[model samples]
Structure formats: C-alpha cells, structure tokens
Target: MKKPQRSTAIFLLILSALLLVAMATFFYLKTQRQSAKTSPTKPALTVSTAALEQSLLPQRLSANGAIWPWQEAVIGSEAGGLRLTEVRVNVGDQVRKGQILATFAIESVQAEVAQAQASLAEAQANALDAAGNAEKARSLQRSGALSEQQINQFQTAEKTASARMLSARAMLEVQQVKLKQTRLLAPDDGVISARNATLGAVVGAGSELFRMIRGGRLEWRAEVTSSELSRIKTGMSVNLLAANGLPIKGKVRMIAPTVDPQTRLALVYVDLPLQAGAPNDPAAIRAGMFASGEFEMGKTMGLTAAQQSVLVRDGFSYVYTLGEDGHARQLKVQTGRRFGERIEIREGLAPGAVLVTSGAGFLNDGDLVRVVNPPMPPTASTAANPVPTKPQP
Candidate 1:
C-alpha cells in the first residue's frame, strides 16, 4: 500500500509538468504565425510590362542557295586553223557588245584576200573580152564573117567566162569573211568570267575562247523545297546576303518548272541588281558562292510583343504574364515571324494580356515580380553634352 501511494504521487507530478509545457509551446506557435502573416514578401525580379499590339508584319519565305549568272554565254572562235595572235582582255574585264576581244595575225588572211581579189580581177577582164567577142560574132552572123558553128562557139565561150567570173567573186567574199573572223568580237555586254585564248596559240574552229555573263547580270539560284516553291511568284522582292556578307537586293526572275530528282528541291532564279554583279562594284558577288535570301510576300496583321518577353526553354517557347496575385504565371506560346524588336505570337496567348517584357528569364512560376516602367532613351542633346570627367592621378 505504501509503494502504490508513492507511484500515484510521481504520476501526478509528471502530468502537471506536461500540461505546463504544452501551454507554453501553443503560445509560442501563435506568436510565430502572427509574425509570418504580417511580414512583406520580397520580389524575385523587377520587370517592365507590355501588352500585345496589332502590327503589320511582313510575310517572308527563306531559302538558301548559291549565286550564279543570270545567263552564261560561251564565246568561241568561228575561224578554224588560225593562230591566236593577241588577247585583248582578261578574266573579270567588263566588255560591251561589238567590242573587239582579241586579234589574230592578219598577214596570212590578208594575203589570201589579195590573191582572191587578183583572181576576181582576171576573171572580170576575161569576161569583158568574152562579151565583146559574142557581140561581134552575133553581128557578123548574117554577113557570113563567121559560120553558124563559129558564132555558137563564141557565145558558149562568153557564157563559160561569165560563170568563172561569178565563181571568183563568191570566192573573194568568202575570203573577206574569213579575214573579219580573225578579230574576235564580243557579242553582248558582259563581264569575262573565263579566258582560254593564248597569244601565239593555234586554236581550232568553234573552240571556246572565253566565257561571259550576259548583260553583266548575276542571279541567285535559291533552293527551295517543293512545298515552298508553290508560294513563290515572278517579280517577288528578295533580299539576299552574299558569301562575303554583302547585302543584295533582287527580284524573282523565274522558278524552275522541274524539281531536282536527287534533292527534290526546285530552283528560284532571282535577278540581282546590276550594281551587285558588276566587276567594278565593291559589293559585287560571284558565281558558285553560297548565300541566304528571303522572298517578301507582302504583309499581314499580327499580335506582336517585345522579343525579350518570349523565351525558349526545353525547345518550347514560353512567356510570363503578371497575375492579380502579384506573381508570374508561365504560359507556353507558339511563335512565328519576327520583326525588328517584336515577335509574332501565333497561339496560346490572348489579346490585351500584359506580359513581362524584360528580366523574364530570371523568374520562375509563382515568382513575385515588381512591374516598372522601361527607361527612356537619351536625347541627342544629352548625348552631345556628356558628363565631364576629372583626370585621374
């Protein structure tokens, strides 16, 4: 009975200590909850807000290809078995139509012309004598100064001599043409792209002597998929970058009717401006150079936002919009054509919604953001009168 009384006293003391501790802990938790509710949450970032606005954006199609000549004209020799005497032009030389490109040693050809002329003169002298003889024979026919057979013989001789003279004249004309062929003349206005003629080199007839780009024109052969080819039309405006990064302006000249079998891509021929292909122009481009270009297909209206407002994450585009609760809500969006500093929002966005224009990449979902106005640009007057600085020691 004494041990049971001692144990009950100890249990009562422990229960009283536990009750006192539980009351103090409950009051401490109440104080902490009240303090947490009254504290201000710090913002994750400060950003500017912008709303989607309707703007006219250009519709464009991009393709990559190589620069080429609008039409390459091969210049070959017409004279056969002649030695090339002189080369008047080199590659990259600009030439005009009817300009003399090269000249051959004309001594031999001129001698042939002289020989033909002499032969023609002799034939003419013989023909004149034959005509006099025929007339004399016909006049003496009735007087019996010549027999009928003799008169016929004289007339036949006159006809034969006349035929020989006519043949000689034709030979002279042929020789004159060969003489003119000795001087190779340019057939069109162009820039020389190649030259095969060598001084003192014997070249065969119809052999290539030079190659030229007709009209001094250059074209961009844009390679486009079969699907993209359908949207292109003649006279469409094109902007291109040369291999050297020179900007070129052009117009669509034509589209190839057939697609390449291996690549299945069609060719779009764009006629570049004359200045862009002239040899003397500093911005001139060359053939066989890879380039990129875009065809302008006019403009259409679209909802655009500042390009910075959109961000790409995991290969998908996203934008942050401010909510009434003062936190960022990350929303996925579909993007399209891009203009100067704005981008087209194709889908997944509603008009008139405000978006974080800058510092969006630093924020995450449910991040508190402080909306602020974008800083204004410096005026010309302020830029001209910059702040003066003191010399450093």
Candidate 2:
C-alpha cells in the first residue's frame, strides 16, 4: 500500500509539469506570429528609372514590295527557219549593246547570198553589153551600117537591161541583210535574265531567244496604304532590305497617282543604285525579289522612352512605372518608330512618368521595387541595341 501511494503522487506531478510546458510553448508561438505579421516586406526587384524624354524622332512609314527591272528587253531572231548553230551566252550573262548572243547555221543564207551575187554579176555584164551596143547604134544613127528600127530596138534593150541590173542589185542587198541576220545580237546593255535559244533546233522569225534587264537597272515597287501615300514624296530617302537581308538605300522616284481598288494600296517606285560589282553578282539584289523598307518622313517631336524599357507581351506593348509607394505599376504603351536607343511613346504614358528602364520583366504589379542610378552607357562600337540587364534586389 505504501509503494502504490508513492507511485500515484509521482505520476500526478509529472502530468502537471507537462501541462505547464505545453502552455509556455503555445504563448511563445503566438508571440512569434505577431512579430512576423509586423515585419517589413522585402523588395522584389531593383531597376533603373528614367524620366520620359521628349525628343525629335524620325517619322517612318513601313512598307513591303518587290524589286523589278526598270525595263526588260526581249532579244529574238529576226530571220526565220534557221538551225541554231551556237549559243554564246546563257542566263545571267552581262552583255554590251550589239553583243552577239547566238548564231544560226549560215550555210543556207550564204548559199542564197551567193546565188543573188551571181545574178547581180550576170545582170551587170548584160547591162554593160547592152549599153555598148546602144552607144554604137547611136553613133551609127546617120550611117547606113544600122537600120532606124534596129537602133530603136537596141536603145530599148539597153534601158531594160539597166533596170534589170538595178533590180538584181536590190535583191542582192536583201540577201546580204538576211545573211547578217543569222547571228543574234543583244539590242541593249544589260544582264541576260533568261535564254530560250536551243542549239540544233530550227526557229522561225521573231522567236524570243533571251530576256534581259536593260541597263542592269532595278527598281523597288513598294506598296503603301492609301493613307500612308501622302507621307511619301519624290526624293524622300528610303532604307530597304532585301529578302537576303542586304541593306540598300534608295530614293522615292515616283508614286502612283491612283490606288488599287481591291487592295487599296498604292505603289511607290524607288530606284536602286547600280550595285558596285558584276551585273549578276550573287551578292547583288536582283529583280523579282521581295523587299521591305521604311520611308523617312522627316522628324517630328514626340515623347520617348529608353528602348530597353519597352516590354512586349501578347503582342501588346507595356512598360513599368514606379508608383508613389515604391511599387511597380504596369502601364500599356503604344510604341512607334524606334530610332537608335529611343522608342517613340505615342500614347498610354504621360510626360514626367518614371519608367523602369531595366529588369521590368522580373517584376509583378504591386511588387515592391528599389530604384537605382543607371550604369554608364556602353560605347557604340562595343554596344548592343538593348543593353543586358538583371534584377538587382
């Protein structure tokens, strides 16, 4: 009985001590919860801020079009029914005016010319004999050596022979022209764009043999909307890029007087310079290549922001500005032409707005932010379009 009484007292004391320790732990946890609730929030990102700048930015109109020849010259054979004997030039060959491009078998033409020449020579001989006989008859007009009727006949024969000789000489000239036509000649200075002449094949007159870009000159026909047409003018500077990404500078040569009814687009003709190399230089832009370009419509005053500050999301332009409470507030902006390091802010932003110039992508709306001074700008030679940035805080 004495041992049982002592064990029960020890168990009761242990339970009371455990209860006190549980109460103390509950109070300590409550105090820690309160302290956590009162603690200050940490900044989510650190970014450089910039004031909205008003600058003179270039007004540009973007357009797309195709490059074409100023004029394409078609070269063909003028003489008919001749076998192609030789092809001197293929497509893309640079040729000067009157350059021989192809030749036909001259055997038939030469034979005909030889026949005509023989005929002409025979006519000349007959004419000389007739003239001599007529002169002799005239000299003997009063002499009894010739009858009057015979003398008249001789005179008439001389006139007929002379006329026949003239006819034969004209026929010879015709044959000579046909003989020269056996060779195909380039009509202009240009680069051959196509060739259709085939060796050993008989072709007729006026059959196209080759196509050339006359003068190696190319023009870009840019399509612009009707509203945008007013902004483009003759002599305005244009910067163009070919499909191969080569940059070319051009000037507006002409603008169409009317727009296409179906597309409501007008053509602006831009003349490209003679590329400084071979006409068919692989590096040079050629006719029929599509291109994109911008027209410099001069300068206009507008609000601008650092190019890096503009963010694009879901095809919408956005920028983050600092709020009075030191939190990031996102604002959608309308972006216009980009010039160098600045982008035109057409709308959705007011002047004097402080924009997060860097690391806005890592931020969320209402997230605390810390602003810092921008680092020194990199030199042009070593700089990229948009400087690399990172969140600092």
lDDT of each: 0.92, 0.90
Model 1 C-alpha lDDT per residue in residues 1-393, reported as the tens digit of each score: 999999999999999999999999999999999988998688889988989999999999999999888889999989888998789999999999999999877888899999999999999999999999999999999999889999999999999999999999999999999999999999999999999988998888999999999988888999999988889999999999888989888899999999999999999999888888778767668888899999999999999999999999999999999899789999999999999999999999999989998799899999998899777888999899988899999
Candidate 2 residue-wise lDDT, 1-393, digit = tens: 999999999999999999999999999999999988998678888788888998998888889999999889988889999999999998888899989999999998899999999999999999999999999999999877999999999999999999999999999999999999998888899999998989999999999989998988899999999987887889999999899888999999999999999999999999889882246567888787999999988898899999999989999999998878898998888998788999999999888888998888888778898888867777886675665689899
Each prediction's TM-score versus the true structure: 0.88, 0.77
Q: What TM-score does model 2 achieve against the real structure?
A: 0.77
Instruction: Give the TM-score comparing model 1 with the true structure, all chains together.
Output: 0.88
- Evaluated at residue 347, the lDDT of candidate 2 is 92
Which pairs of residues have clashing backbones in candidate 2?
none
Give the distance in Å from residue 229's predicted Cα in candidate 1 to where it truly belongs: 2.6
Q: When superposed on Cα atoms, how far off is each prediction in RMSD?
A: 5.6, 8.3
Shift in Å, residue 47, candidate 1? 1.7
Runs of candidate 2 with Cα error greater than 4 angstroms are 1-41, 132-156, 276-280, 375-393
Question: In model 1, what lDDT does residue 336 have?
Answer: 97
